[model samples]
Target: MATVLLLRHGRTTANADGTLAGRLPVPLDDVGHDQARAVGERLRRLPLAGVVSSPLRRCRQTLRRALPGAAVTVERRLTECGYGDWEGRSLSELATDPLWQDVQRRPSAVSFPAGEAMAAMAARAVAAIRDWDARITAQHGPGALWLACSHGDVIKAVLADALGLHLDGFQRIVVDPASVSAIRFTPQRPFLLALNDTGGDLRALAPPPGAADSADAPVGGGSGAR
Candidate 1:
């Protein structure tokens, strides 16, 4: 029954342009850096037992700014999806391409000319979350609270698996840049405390599991498709 907080990294130059950045290793832009600082300032006071992040530059950069001194661990499995040939292309550019348009509706069947299958991305992401859960529990304790800095696609896939939600259902939930999605687990099951919470005051963003006034936490929504 550990508490897992999945944090999507801040925006990047590609993000601003609506580009697909799977395994692209793009770093945060100036705006992204500022957003990460704001996010870090917001969550600085949270009672996090440990911090973990994907090895990708974007996730790493966000973690460095947000959790300055927290014991940060690099998790390769949590890296963003591998978009293959679609790597730096914007959505609009891909729209004109038949392969891109086909994948939009039949994600499971479509793959970038050189990219990964959506199912594979979803599977790997789930595996990473399961591994992370086991690793955290083994190292910290069953009830430890931890934060994971990761990519949007990875976060969506992990949550979909953890909550037993369908991939289509996942497409209905959106994860905003630098947003925090809080999930808490008990011996019985897992619950989503909040989703896509934007910055206001980090302290007011979301409450830890078992907090008395968790009912007062803020809320936001969008399809989790990123």
Candidate 2:
């Protein structure tokens, strides 16, 4: 089995103001940095096979601080939704828009006013995970752990797909910033091991120190989404 840890980037000024950051270059706020450090400390105990992150500054910073010396690959497929025209807008401001209701109640049919489609986001994200799962499984073998640090909606979409839930139902899934979720892929089936696991203490899922560790191995890197 190959396990992927979906780690959402920490808080930012937009997040604090209930704004939609979209693919902006928003940096993490003080609390977000603190959260990243805490999550990092908890994750450092595990011997991760790889650390992947979105190219966004906020996510990149979070991964760098959390994993410290671990080499991180930027996967654009794991980017935050392209909120397009809504970038930097307040959540409260969008609440009255009829599209907002559709977003929360019928996400599967949503095509942002000028942004990415919900289904498209899920498709690419899921595809990316499948590819990474196979690559990591082959390199580290079964029961190995890898990290995919990305945005909240992105992680929720991954969670929804793994749990066999409807895309619209993804709205019900809460993925807080700096949270950790796990989805392990096995030959027999896919497993949803964790969701929004922010308390850390993930030692139980670790494959033991030096157990299939790939710290010295280099993984590919590239530009990523916010």
Candidate 3:
């Protein structure tokens, strides 16, 4: 068995403003950096064997701080869902846009107009998790601790796959910036130990300002929009 830690990336300029970053390469702001540092401090106490990250800058940056100097690997399969034309657009903007409305009404049926399908994205994300799990088991014996830094969409997809949940349940889970989710894997199945935990001492490690969406605020927002 191996312990897999799923880490959401720190806040980005778009995330703070409630915009859809959607595969956009947004770097972390000052607060995001701080959050990453704080998360790193907390993880230092864990027996992390390896670190993996999405190719996006924000996710990469968060992983750097959370597991500095640790053996890091970049997996494109872990990248966030591609929003297509809505990559950097806001919800409000999409609400008024007909295509955006189509995306909302039938996301699984609709592509980003020119973007990737949700099913494909989710499958890729799951594949990445499974691949990482296999790698850990092969390299560090069966009981290993491996970390993956990814995004809301990708992480949610992984969660859905691990927990036998549906895509709609993606909104049922809350993965905050710098928050941690853990899973244990055996040859037969994967077990969820925790989900969306942000209980670390913020006095020494506060989340960066605007790192989270106000739609899901007050610490545990209880899973709002994806």
Candidate lDDT (C-alpha), each: 0.74, 0.84, 0.75
Clashes of each: 8, 1, 1
Error of 2 at 56 (Å): 0.8
Write candidate 2's Cα lDDT for 1-226 as tens digits.
Answer: 5788999999998999899899999999999999999999989988799888888999998987898878999899998888778788899999988889999999889888789998999999998888998999889887688999999888999899888899989998999989999877655556676789889578766544443333232246412111
Compare the candidates by TM-score and give the number of the best one.
2
**Tens-digit per-residue lDDT, 42-143, candidate 1:** 778776777888888899889888877678988877887777887888888978988765565556666666767777888877776667766776777665
Model 2, residue pairs in steric clash: 55-224
TM-score per prediction, in order, is 0.82, 0.90, 0.82
RMSD of every prediction: 5.7, 8.4, 9.5
Rank candidates by lDDT, best first. 2, 3, 1
Clash-forming residue pairs, model 3 = 31-208
Candidate 3 residue-wise lDDT, 142-226, digit = tens: 5577789999878877887788887655656788888888776666567666688776532222222332212222366433222
Q: Which lDDT value does model 1 have at 160?
A: 71
lDDT of 2: 0.84
TM-score of 3: 0.82
